[model samples]
Target chain A: MKKKKSSIADKIFVACNTLFMIAFVVITLYPVLNTLAISFNDGIDAVRGGIYLVPRKFTLENYQTVLGKQNMMTGAYITLLRTIIGTVFALVSNALLAFIVSRKRFLFKSQLSLFWVITMYVNGGMIPVFLLYRNLHLTGTFWVYVVPGAVSAFNMLVLRTYMQGLPDSLEESAQLDGAGYWTVFSKIISPLCKPVYATVALFVAVYQWNSWFDAMLYNRMKSEYTTLQYELMKLLSSVMQQSGSAANAAAAGATASAVTPVSVRAAATIATMLPIICLYPFLQRYFVAGLTIGGVKE
Target chain B: MARNTKTNAPAVKITWKEVKRQKFLLFWAAVFVIYGVIFYYLPLGGWIMAFQNYKPKDGFLHSKFVGFDKFIFLFQDDTFLKVLRNTLGMGILNLVSTFIMAIVFAILLNEVRSKIGKKAVQTISYLPHFLSWIIVTGILHDALSTSGIVNEVLMKLNIIDKEVNFFAHPGFFWPIVAFANCWKETGWNAIIYLAAITSIDPCLYEAASIDGAGRWAKIRYITLPGIKPTIMILLLMNVGNVLNAGFEVQYLLGNGLIKSVSDTIDIYVLTWGISQNDYSLGTAAGIFKSVVSIILIVIANYMAKRAGEERLF
Candidate 1:
């Protein structure tokens, strides 16, 4: 009797687990896939009926329109440049700071660490940051993106913690082999810290990629150099606002003729998000391990 | 003890000498110090603009001093007050909903013993985190539009007599924003908790099973308690950022019609700082927000310490 009941319970457990897992998969994948379907669907069809899981009438016209727009392509180029330059500067600065802070024997390490931590808790906020950019003459320039957010405190802490976990014996052996501290750090420590470096690199890259707020705040000469996300936001907001105004006009007994190109907007969204989404699967292994390591307390 | 101290003297001396010899360490340290001084500390000095009627042309030092006027103006402004309320309301909603969903998702995900199934689920969920908020807002635009999928589905099901204007209505705006936040972030946020869940000893589950405990009982008695520390730590750390209610989504989703309910402190700052060119008022608001956040963090840390849990400090 006990054996039969236990088997039945086990079967129920497995079935429940499978059901939950499938639900999670569906909830996560559906919205993204839905967006993709809308992006591919013909604009008119996409608007008339909701494109859910699949495209009703498949088309790449939306992509062509978004890409063919000279402004968006220019924005993409600017964003790419910013990401590359910002990541490099951030990574170098962060790695150097982490190395210094990781050395327990270094004087004022604790004080410096506290300083960095305090920055994480408190900031001068956006306006002051804007003023600072203005003072430095960084606004409306490429340096606006790269210089202001060159180092992140959280990334520094993560790198420092990762470095701390490495055995001191490695540095000691390098010292015994007549290598200087710089040489050891460059030739030995950095190579060993690849996984953490890769992790930090990915974090910085994503930050640069998704960042539009900085551009929105500082870069007023939008025609000169807007980031990809910012351009998309502008486009989306404009369409929504136009539609809103049209509705108001109609409510006021005026002819509301302005139509929001919903398909074009969806296409722009899909286009803007395409590179990162495609890059995600490749970075999945590192991303999961990095997140797990970073979140797991020592 | 005397012999041990005498023997450690040479090691200590060597360590001191090594530190002195490594001038390169000092070089790199100085480089970082310079970076921080220029970028981090200098911007902080710009906070003085909060006390001044800051003009871009007048500059920080030359700006006319009007101490506390901007802050006073902020407190008196109805729009500012509404923004504050909206920020806190949306933040609290996001906090509660995301917290519940993350924990539930983590628990459910933990039950999956199939490797491939778990991996696939994880990959799909984590994808949204990589998406920019702009794109997410775009998705929401389409999904919640009058002729959008959500309304279509609802109408087909006879749930509503007419299309609901999900975005324009102030009452619905906050919830829609919160729901979008939860949808975008829950899976990614659950990851930390899921990692915590895995670290729980399997032997505890075995013991529960031996005691004839069912799955729910095992979860309550064993799993919940095990991940409680992780949850508490994350919650405390996040309390400092409650005012951040997110900028991009709220900004993108907000319209003039729903602005009263949707404008957050960040949006308020952006408006004053960028749109009006009243940098002083914006700086004042920003400073106020930052100060409150710091206070909350310190208090949270102190409370967590008293409770004998892991604190950010």
Candidate 2:
């Protein structure tokens, strides 16, 4: 709410804020638009510089080159597969654990919670975890992703809090009817917990989609197991090399450079980025509620 | 978890039927405990390798137990100390900049009158948060390149004589990473604060205006004080992640030339323990980081408690 009499300072502040917001919007949008421009522009034109906002000498060749690269399709398929299966597994295990413990009929609730909560305070750090995964012989295997992350303590807690908020009479009626735990969970609680479940599901899905570090750490040089993010990372690293040595390459002789790696790298960045951007608008409604649930403790 | 009045349900305690009925559910819950034990609790034993002359073949069991030798060696190493310096330097810088920027963004966004404009800006800004760091760093690398837009625009505007190799210089490393972090996270970080601001009663603004409070005065007094608890809670929580200045960005953006200013404890552990085959030393470095992190979090919680702010625990 503002006063009816707007002061000169208030007018100045409003003008300044408006200007700043416009500049802020441009600052945020420019790089993304530039990257898009580079991805579409002719490779030579992109490398020679001065391309911004819009494509210069536009071509789809960069995308073709990026998509046509070795193991590109395979990497996409792998990322898709892992994201689906991993999110499902994580949701099932975490939600079940949360729901089961949330039931008052089940004693040892505090102890069950404490067993997992202790993990939040202490960890073996990266080295030991890596070694443990190595010792388990899960590294370099697909199970490495699914098995370790099946039960996220944080997700479990969030789900538990949500489940706690549901009216008990619903479950009590089902219990009186001699409904089994699985029946009660499926026929009643599952329908009731959709919002929080969707929120947690989105978190795991995003985490699964974006993760490259685990694949890098565990899978090592296994190209077959490469994720989309890892493929993009590989492309980026190669672009770095080319950017560094393009001048050297020209001096040493060879005018056969059809497409600079920079263009393909931009294309690859967009490819890796496209999934999140496209899905984000639809999922945007879920994020604020998700973040609040995740950040705030009951 | 249900807060129902179940006192009228007839106390049917210590019944065999109930135990049989509940056994399956309890067993299912116990599976989580089993997984937690195997995945989390067990690896803690591997921290013992930090105190050993660890060799892969021998493992922690057969390795010669050398107490704090690796730690002393880590402290004695100049490179390791410099890595710590770079880590703390970048961590504090990022924390301060991002914290202020996020709050400022929240305050500014709260000042906007148009709902559509506010929502549109907020949506577009937090869009970066969904992106993986690998992608974020790739964008940074592209945009900050020698012949990239930054240099191109600067040179055209007669701001510079030539293209600046931003990544090549160690002195620019901390600020580059800090700004990159601010770009990616500031808007998203402001969301909670905006929610805090919205929760402040409109009557406060109305009352302040009647008292001849300007926009700046109201923001300084009412708006700020409303979000103080939220700010304190966030600060206390983030203090625990101080050591995690992050691994991916530094590892991606850094190279041998800037290694002096780029390496953090995570990078150090990865390079030394895994890559260099010095598992013991890496574990020692990791253990040092973890211990200090735990201490910092405890101290932060204590301070919050003393100040009558929100304590994490």
Per-residue CA lDDT of model 2 for B115-222, tens digit only, reads: 999989998888888888888888888788887778878988999997889888888899999998889888888888888898899999999999999989999999
TM-score of each: 0.91, 0.95
Candidate 2 Cα errors over 4 Å, as ranges: A244-257, A296-298, B1-18
Candidate 2 lands at a TM-score of 0.95
Would you list the C-alpha lDDT of every candidate in the order shown? 0.78, 0.83
Per-residue accuracy of model 1 over B1-313 as CA lDDT, tens digit each: 0001011112223366766776788777777778787778877887888899877787767889998999999999999998889888888898888889889888888777667877778778777788888888877786787867777889989999899888878899878988888778887888888888888998888877778887778889999999999898888878888887657788888888888888999999988887898878888888888888788878988999999987776
In candidate 1 chain A, where is summed lDDT lowest over 10 consecutive residues? A251-260
Pairs that collide, model 2 = none
Q: Give the TM-score comparing model 1 with the true structure, all chains together.
A: 0.91
Docking class of 1: acceptable
Instruction: Give the clash count for each candidate.
Output: 0, 0
When only the first chain is scored, the TM-scores of the models are 0.87, 0.93
